[model samples]
Target: MPELLIDIPSTFVERIERLAAEENESLEDMAMLLLRRGYDFAVTRPEVEPDRSQRPGARSDARLDWWREARFGLFIHWGLYSVPAGVWKGRDWPGIAEWLMYRAEIPVQEYEKLAAQFNPVKFDAKAWVSLAKRAGQKYLVITSKHHDGFCLFDSAVTDYDMVDATPFKRDVLKELAEACAAQGIKLGFYYSQTQDWHHPDGDGNDWDFDPAEKDFAGYIEDYVKPHVRELLTNYGPIGIIWFDTPKGISEEQSRSLLALCNELQPDCLVCGRLGNALGDYATAGDNRIPEEVLDLDWETPATINDSWSYKINDHNWKSSVDLIRKLVDIVSKGGNYLLNVGPTGEGVIPQPNVERLEAMGRWLEVNGEAVYGTQPGPIQGRADLRTTSKEGVIYLHVFDWPADGQIRVEGVAAQGARLLAGGAALPVEVSSGALVISVPEEAPDEAATVIALR
Candidate 1:
């Protein structure tokens, strides 16, 4: 008999051996059983090549055309942290709800207890995807694994996942993937590559593990890489692998992760947080937009409220008017708006979040032409006014409707002007190298009113 060798992470090998014993089968037969369950032993290229080439120490634009044109997307941050909802031992932590573990410095054994009670019976994949679609989001990104190191999908590498550990026993990511496909929305995963508080060797667990003795490289090889591989392999086609908190990740480690994404799903985009400026696009700070237009492709990830994860007391929701205006501002500055929602532990999006999204959807139904597939307009540096352009037409987004019924747009030569909401032409005149247009005394929409000029 000849011997065949397969090199994989030790964790997977242990899983296979354990299964072999439980099933009363040979090791090879157990390996075959695992393979039959859709386990990919090796990385293989898909039929189509990536859109852009990747070079060492350089970021590749690879398949971001749809992302750039999308203009807006949905970000979901759901995990065990949602179960706590930002209160630890009856004390409400005041910050991002997801950082409850790190902020309070809870013990691993105690924090892991949340898994026993983690059951989101109300989670509806179809409904979630439909909401994103209704909100005019072209793509969706969910946190597959956050800093707490909780896994939302079934992993052969570990059992501390939604399926095995939690009472829900359902793979949330799998359901979301199917729903996204059915709804025609691109899917992306947010994985915390560097910070895994649960694991002893993983970064950000100083309370449990001695940092001096921890083998960070070993953790990357055994845990992080395996999880990333599992994500790319199990999912049908991932749009983006959004990594967060690079902290102490080495340049070599970042490149290695990039190589894995390239090898498995070349079309999948790697965001800048993967570290060392090797992402297809740059990501702005949380809830922070750039002051000026960045030369490279960038996106601003913002929360619907102040918290990224669900917080019972965090009622400070941004108004629909402010959110709509924020969307216009980001697009005008040549960036994508990744609006986030923190669903309750019961799997229901807070009603306020739903209402805001619906309102934005209604706003988009009439003014989508001004937003979708548009470029940053020629006009810049105005707080009350922002602009987006498609083809030769420019869209003037008036956040603060001029009460005087007259507005002046600089550096534009307009032959005609009309309201996008009503298609009613307005009077226009040229004066002092600017186009002055007459408007209604009252704005049609409270959020933002658009004027199309050509």
Candidate 2:
């Protein structure tokens, strides 16, 4: 957990290459082995314990408190790939922005050319955090590094990062951290574990692979871990280290990484993608929310559109009402919803994405009371409806309102009821062991109607 900058010896790289050939292992495997040894050594080596000031709370217990309370967050997937803005050469790329190179099978050198022109002149950290705050997002998770292997932050470990390589030389992560601090939004970093095909050690394919020439494991030790240390130490109190791609990581290595985070900032949260349960919360990928999330902490990440990164031709963005419904649905099921927004290459979130968020913000302005501080219901209701509770009051969110001004809800024996939208006293009576209430002639909102019960 030392904040010292990593300095790898030139001979170390040669040794790694030699070791890989001797073991008949791929460079990636050798890199993992070296990293495992380095991390193990770092953790076990004795050093003077620094001042305990600003240290985080117990990892196991502190995170649960935050997890249960944070019902909604904003997931941002912006990077150099956004600069391509979903276009390769002169034609439009069909896949996501991050995958523009891979999907198009563009040569690494060709994709690297985009980096020279990558400049987010309109990038405004304050504006970005303000949007998330207005949308009622309690936390913000930005992609610090994606599968493309480009680092968003300024890492001394490599020149292939945002600060040194791209035209936009500012530390995006640093500015974001400052903005989140100013706005009181918890900040988290999403780090992809897999290296990109563009890097030197990452050039091999599944077929006709050779391990002698490339030292993949050395890259992990010399590049990845050191960069992670820099991130944890430099970024003032990152709330979470959201790791991705545990494909090559071993349980021991994962545990060591988690331990490093805990040692550096004990309160920092980690996600389930870190190989073992080393992560504090379980993550459900895009649009794949669980019907019954486990009793433990969990979150579901989904995009407003089909892709995580902005796609010009991708017109499948979810409406504000749909996004709000999804948020309510997830919260009612005891989970946090991390809705994603992909900004264009010039550092502007598309007009459609901004419009949807604004609309959702308006709805939240009125209905946030039932969401912000509420806990999940004791019993999940029917498919068309959901429930959340605050104090002794239960709020039933009816997704599909019944016609004929009558709605029947089971399992809740309520003594009194009221309409949350209008605050009008509702007449509730029990019949045949079910609670029946009179619905308004028309729905308060086209999306869903919330009824408060005590």
Candidate 3:
């Protein structure tokens, strides 16, 4: 499509921007909305939804039911950047290892050399999917391509991919898709649509490609769209197409990518970072959980440790207890938790990550009913206690057990109560117009104990 240039008043542009922010939409969407309203007024007819049911591979809202019920997932960040492991020329970068190429300001040619060394010989698709299943993760989203423009899957669009660029020469995404299917876990892919440092026409390579002379449209049509098509066509029923860092992408481009995903696989979801607020689900900021419950579908993507990719010096890891609590907190607020694991260049998930995930798996083995397929509880903003509900039964997740052997909750009357983990009954009484449940002094589980109320 050819670009349409129009001149609008500066005041109108500002107003459009404000409206977009208020509605959580893009400025272009707002402008188009205004145009649509004007046209409706002139036509004297009510607005109608586009008839998409007849379209090829038409999308259905039913596809998202599984995602809504799935409270936990795994995120993998692996690419050429893992080869350097945040150390470029003997200097340890202090931030995310995935952004090493841009942070170090390495030339495109120099960064391309990393692809030759990007041999993940130990990468095991079945083992990775098995870990997610054991951790009680319902889905897995891997980085098909990162901002560094390195691809983990085979891409006919470019030879700058794992299959053709490295010694391992394997399509990890293909193997992962197969493994996930066999394990009954949903699969997703993370592709950096706008930012491709190696491609001159793509965004975010100012060190080499002059932005003024770049043909971003060419990058989108010739490269981005093709890559996306191949992913949706090759991968069997992808759970999500996770795009990141919209950068300078236009609303039209965002919609085009979203439409393509819909056309290829109607069930596959598009994340919020696709830009223009066109995603099927909203994505929270990195490592951030909402302070209050959200009415819409949303998710929080977080790292097990500080860096998303492997960094030899970054030993700081979140404890299993903390991770469990975080998962409970997110679920209580009607959101999904996508925890990340950064594998080494040798294709090994760090031992620390493995231990933490195993611990989480053990915790979920006992209390998974409280986390999975549950809705947000009526209670809100309680630090010590969070709640999840399913089939009219409420489950209280106690992070900090009371020492007095009594836990009181207002505005709720429990006919009966029992420990979800152990199925042991507890005494419940109505006192001061509140339901007080008597329990043991010591918590049944340190990482958020679940008590079911009937």
Question: Which numbered prediction scores highest in lDDT against the true structure?
Answer: 3
Q: Global lDDT of each model?
A: 0.87, 0.77, 0.88
lDDT of 2: 0.77
Q: Model 3, poorest ten-residue lDDT window?
A: 46-55
User: In model 3, what lDDT does residue 413 have?
Assistant: 72
Q: Over 4 Å off in model 1, which ranges? A: 1-62
Model 2: worst 10 consecutive residues (lDDT sum): 46-55
Candidate 2 C-alpha lDDT tens digits along 171-207: 9999999999999999999987554556666532221
Candidate 2 Cα RMSD (Å): 11.2
| Cα TM-score of candidate 3 | 0.87
Q: CA shift at 116, candidate 1, in angstroms? A: 0.7
After superposition on all C-alphas, the RMSD of every candidate to the true structure, in Å, is: 15.2, 11.2, 10.4
> For model 1, how does the per-residue alpha-carbon lDDT over 9-69 read when each residue is reduced to its tens digit?
4545776898899999998888877776664522232211122112343323537788888
Those runs of model 3 whose alpha carbons end farther than 4 Å from true positions after fitting are: 1-60
TM-score of each: 0.86, 0.83, 0.87
